[model samples]
Target: MATVTFIPAPAPDHTASLRAAVRYGVLGLIVLAVVGSIVATLLAGMPGLYGALLGAAVGGGFILCTALGVLFTAKLPATTAGAVLLGTWLLKMILAITVLAILKPLDFYDKTALVLVIVLSLVIVLGAETYGVLGVKAPYVEPRAAGDAEPGEKDAQ
Candidate 1:
């Protein structure tokens, strides 16, 4: 007789959903980065290339950071997790503004290419994360009614 080993499945919970979302988000970012780089380069040469890279890093990284924050705080209390997520959101906004301000006067990168790639990255990554989150098979428990007989119990004769 052959011996068989079975691996336990992961729990269907917030962490599982988060892990899926993060995995898909990273995949989306990578795909966007590669395609954006190629397309931008063909459109505007080296400047376009630089723009696409910057856009992918800034846009994708911004959203990815939020997912990571939630994943990191999955085990914490609900209020604490919410607070951390809100804080991260604020920080991301500040960082985005600062980055845009710094890049405003610099002409080394193609602005149009940067904007397009940023928008595309945002849409694609967000869609991918949404898909991932929706794909998880979360377990559901049905509430038992009052006065229900115990499982496997027989009524008195």
Candidate 2:
């Protein structure tokens, strides 16, 4: 019988990760707003500029909060790390909901445009963060042995 062992994944990455996340997130949010404005203008055109502004506010607020949370946690004691991060996350959710609730009932803008921009911003920011984080180098994985042949190749030889 042969033993099969699996190696564990890498550990926490650098603070540069937050930079990458926020950079990409902001870029995506900007693109969403521009494209959304054009489309909304051509379609419903129901005071779209304000809606797009509101959506940008929502997305930008989330990104800013997350960046602050990441920075704050990195400086805290290990025992309180989890608690701080969770609390920040809860705060962000509540703030987002409150913003939406307050803005959705307003008659000055198109609700559909605002909703679409907010949803797209969330998706793009998430994708950017995942992509950016994955770009960080994994420094802990040990190098492979030199000239090590596979078991099947050795048997064939």
Candidate 3:
């Protein structure tokens, strides 16, 4: 009978880690941009001049937060990362509703802002999840022939 051996999959490396980081960063930025634009439009009370600026700020801030969060918690699992995102979304929603309710009684709150907040919050959470999934790195492995040298090399007999 002939003997058989199986080779395991190769481990992840630094290049993979860097690539993940970049991918997550871009995802974060895109999410922020979309959410920001919507919020800015709502804030402008119209699709006029100032809306564009507000949208940019909102989107930029969201992206920045996501990047920082990923950088700080890169070791977290995809599920845990998702949970964190969901928690943030919940908090934002609660805050928006509470603030709107409080201000509505005084005629100082805009109903449209609530919608903007909800949309932005969802974008942020989804973006974070996307980044978390992309950034995951598996264990690394050493080459099988690390200790072996080719003919005429110093370690070769």
Best of the candidates, TM-score: 1
Error of 1 at 129 (Å): 0.4
TM-score of each: 0.82, 0.69, 0.37
TM-score of 2: 0.69
Per-residue CA lDDT of model 2 for 40-138, tens digit only, reads 777767578777767766876686577667766766787697788888889889998998788766789888778887777777767877677667664
Clashes of 2: 0
**lDDT of candidates 1 onward, in order:** 0.90, 0.73, 0.53
Greater-TM-score candidate between 2 and 3? 2
Per-residue lDDT over 4-60 for candidate 1, one digit per residue giving the tens place of the 0 to 100 score: 998657557657778999999999999999999999999999999999999999999
- 1 or 2, greater by TM-score: 1
lDDT of 2: 0.73
Q: Which pairs clash inside model 3?
A: none
Give candidate 2 regions above 4 Å deviation. 1-13, 138-157
Output the number of the lDDT-best candidate.
1
Higher-lDDT candidate of 1 and 3 = 1
Candidate 3, superposed: residue stretches over 4 Å from native: 1-3, 45-135, 138-157
Candidates 1 and 3 compared by TM-score, better number:
1
Model 2: residue 100 alpha-carbon error in angstroms: 1.9
Steric overlap count per candidate: 0, 0, 0
